[model samples]
Target: MKRISSIFCVALIGCLLQGCEKKIDLELKTTTPIIVVDGRVTNSSSEGSVVALSYTKTVKSDNSIVPLTGATVTIQEGNGTVYSLPEVSNGVYRNASLTGIVGKTYHLTVVANGQTLTSSSTMPTMVAFDSLVAEDFPGFGKTIKVVTPFYNDPPGYGNQYNLSIIKNGKLIKDVFAYDDLFIDGKKATFPLIYSRKADEFKKGDLIEVVMNCIDHANYKYWFSFSQSSTGSPQAVPDNPISNINGRAIGVFGAVTFQKRSIVIQ
Candidate 1:
């Protein structure tokens, strides 16, 4: 697996921007094909377990990314409840009824293109999101408005978090992971800074903030992604630390999330 791991170190532009457009140029000297696995299960009743499978693009490939099809995907609960996810489209598998439960662990298994990949994650209890406070920060010779969320961290060590900002229903493209290294069981607040200056919200815009209580493995994945997304030309890009065990690249996360919204003033 170590030899396979070194051949597919992807310098991801920004994992935070799931819906944003990106262009990657690979200069690696390898001919081995890679399988990418991305799976997630959330606590929301309206959400479901979604796993997307795809092949890594190479310099010899065309502009479009190729998806891996006809794969078997299954998720098992710690209590031995197994749910099969059917392919809904090209390479995406989903089971809408499989809502994640807090404190329960989940195992993901995927068999595709002659490779077997698996991972496990436990959903953490949600931390209450109290309020969204908008404030101004002096930067680049001007005052920039930003939204900060206030929450009380639960009284336990190793509480990690993944935050997402949505403006007028569209997701913001930036990394927002947090940990209780300094403020465990205490009041916590931080501004949701935008990577691009034009992404800042204006007055009258509707803003929604989501906080996902995640395990340490998922937290490290997001934190590593945040580091690799520096947008610096001089920085050599590498793949984020994945929880999945196999000859694959990506993550499988079981998370419980809470959300709050506010209208920019």
Candidate 2:
């Protein structure tokens, strides 16, 4: 009798659960497209300055980017000299003669789609890279190899930096931003952490690192963008802080950088 009672109860519960089963379709809100500007000026004569324009993507639309072309782009030095960046390709403007100078400020002006946008950034002094050392670190049931860079943070506050990694001649698409909040005016060893089992370092692998000394505004933009991209718990689902104003979302960074390469042994 107890077995029969249990079977009946189980049948009754199944019927109740089937009655409660329902499908839910979520209606996500779509956002309007906005202008996105990516511009950079570096303190290297061998490299040219570039400003690329594009339209933002919406969830319902295709993920392909729509480039903004035929717009006026110019970079003006603090000394009142302006260099018009000619369009080398669609939606991309470049000025080969405009190299950033440390301690000098640069202003970017863009007129696109009948909207004007402008922003300014100052180039900070270059910090010397002392050495690059590759070390093995213990990982989850495996050994991980990473490159550690040694440098001295200059005295005073507000020193910001961005490091880009190039592995085997291909740029790693990650942002590594550092600030001198804890180790101000002190020697420090910061490790470059890029964990990919498929892209792990092997014998004779070449790794190049570019350490850029950027200003405070640029640091905030990069740090915020990194946090959002990594899906941090504290990150808000919004665009990163932009220095550019007037209907555009992006950053203009004047950076002084140094590059160094190391081979994994």
Clashing pairs in 1: none
Q: Give lDDT tens digits, candidate 2, residues 87-145.
A: 99988899988898888899999998788999888899888988888999866468878
Provide the global lDDT of candidate 2 against the true structure.
0.73
Using all chains and alpha carbons, the TM-scores for the candidates as numbered come to 0.80, 0.80
Per-residue lDDT value at 149 in model 2: 85
Q: Give one digit per residue, the lDDT tens place, for model 1 in 146-193.
A: 899998998877687888888899877676777776667889877877
Sequence-dependent TM-score of model 1: 0.80
Q: Looking at model 2, report the run of 10 residues with the lowest lDDT sum.
A: 19-28
